[model samples]
Target: MSHPTADRARQLLDLHTQPEILVLPNVWDVVSAQVVAATPGVHALATASHSIASTFGYPDGERIPLDLHLDMVRRIVQAVSLPVSMDMESGYGHPGDTARRAIEIGVVGGNLEDGMRPLGEAVAAVQAVMDAGRAAGVDFVLNARTDAALRADPQAPRSSVIEEVITRGRAFLDAGAPVVFVPGLVARDEIQEVSDAFGPRKLTLISVPGASLPARELQALGVSRLSTGPFTQRVALTALQDAAAEIVAGGTLPAGTRPLN
Candidate 1:
């Protein structure tokens, strides 16, 4: 019989290739995971590191302990049947060790970014994740993220940043990264440029959160994945704030506001 875990990994991978764009509203905790899992046509679940950290009152950049993060991921994984991917910012520990823990909880994929570490070190970590996946017999998809174009260092020129992204993206893909994630490149033309550079490699776009470029625009640009990171959570928070203020002011609650018993 086929390995169930392997099948889950394959299922997650298959979603990335379907005709309709795979839209992942990255979730933070178990409730959010369950909510997304229960939604119609959600192919897979992903955790946004920023949102997860905030959910626990911790800052991003691995301020939360690796074990704590893993436990939360475990709960979310157990709460739903969809395959889940983690935003493992810089692995926190070695990527191989992190991958082992994540696999233990049935995660089939993860986003491993450089987190502004030395280029060589980041590349090595990516290799470690790939190796761990191989040893575990899980086709774990590692979405290798390069930050060159993420913040656009004031010191570096735009051309240089794009150049670095392509360079790192190429090296990572060559080293076995399944997806090249460039989160901060939101412009339609830039998206196209990056896609053109990567060719067959999958580009995970965290660009234009909540309809910046629209789904069709991204699909036309050859984006394999669109991660609506933490932004979705932020939108919910905004709505809640509005509803609370309305009630405090003795006004009618918003249409979707619910009271907690």
Candidate 2:
């Protein structure tokens, strides 16, 4: 199998001819990465940080150490032939440390979020990370995430949500982030509004099972990219549970469920 090259990732980002948004199914491991890469038109692979952390018996909130996370990135990169982007939650440290380690492991892209930092400080962190990538000769696609909706109360005003995301997104872009990811955005009109507000700027929309609109529909609204973001991992876990329950209930294995070697 072919391995992902830096040039391939750069080419993927340079294509801005259409309103067609790239759908990136989040993968937790080498097997999932290979499965997603086998699907047609899946030009890139994105790592779900939550999924990765959970697999290692850790929670999603920066629980996994940086060395282990980079090791996982290296393994996934070796396993798949498509460009791999990682969900580098809060950069796992200060911006420079995270970005340097990410590029060192051959990750072509990653997401950094403005979690607890002030907006300006977050931008500066991201800028340091981008500089680290450039110094390593990797053209990293940094998709900065603004987590206002996830943190704020559900009853928060829509205007407050919009204002925070736009403010953070602008700073990230100015600091060299190629794309801005807004998680927890659900409504079609809201997605369109964000897309319109960031015209010519790349925007990444994340989908949760019931919280967000469908991926194809979001693409139609001009989103630059779509990610499942730990949803697929949950689906896999649910399936395993159901299968185990069936066995415990004296149900026989379905025919052709196992392959012959």
Candidate 3:
């Protein structure tokens, strides 16, 4: 019999190849995971480090202990049948070890951030993650990320930033990441340029609310995946805040609120 997680990993990998853009509304916990997995069209799930951290009362950037973070991931994996990927923020200072632990808990894939680390170091991190997947007998979907667009110097020319993104993105792909995530590159022309540089269906993108293009437009640009990084949780929290405010001001909870858990 096939390893269950291996099967899930393969299924997750296959989603990237289909003509439809793989849309992942990143979740923070079991309830969110269950809700997204229960959605009609969602094929897989991914965790948002920022949201997960917030849910646990910590700030982002891996402020939560590695053990604590992996514990949450383990619960999420147990809570859903769909393949789940983690946002391994900068690998928590040890890319390979963190991935190995995540895999041991049934996580089939993850996003590894570069954070504008040295090119050689970033490439090695990608290789380390894929290596861990191999040792675990799973084809991990490594969505290698370069924060070039986010970390770019304010005074730097836009072309230079694009150059930095392409440079790191190419290196990440060459090192075995299935897709390169350019998180802050939202413009049509720039998206087209990066997609062209990376060839069809090799680039993955993050959708910032009010900033990203529509899924159809991203698909037309030849992008392979669109991840809603932390926005899903943010939207949920926004609704919660509004509801709380209403209750404090003599208003009742909205009758339309759906119980997801």
Best by lDDT: 3
Q: How do the residues 40-137 of candidate 1 rate in per-residue lDDT, one tens digit apiece?
A: 87889999888888989998889988888898999998988889999899887788899878987899999998865777888899999988888888
Superposed model 2: Cα runs more than 4 Å off: 1-4, 15-18, 254-261
| C-alpha root-mean-square deviation, candidate 2 | 2.7
Q: Which residue runs of candidate 3 sit more than 4 Å off their true CA positions?
A: none
Looking at candidate 2, the ten consecutive residues that score lowest on lDDT are 252-261
Q: Write the per-residue lDDT of candidate 3 for residues 160-198, one digit (tens) a residue.
A: 999999999999889989889998899999999999998
lDDT-better candidate, 1 vs 3? 3
Backbone clashes under 3 angstroms, per model: 0, 0, 0
Q: Rate the local accuracy (lDDT) of all candidates.
A: 0.84, 0.80, 0.93
**Location of the lowest summed lDDT over 10 successive residues in candidate 3:** 198-207
True lDDT of residue 119, candidate 1: 76
Model 2 agreement with the true structure over 140-246: per-residue lDDT tens digits = 78888888756767788987888777777777877888888888778787778878877753778877886777777777788888889889999878877888888
**TM-score, ranked from best to worst:** 3, 1, 2
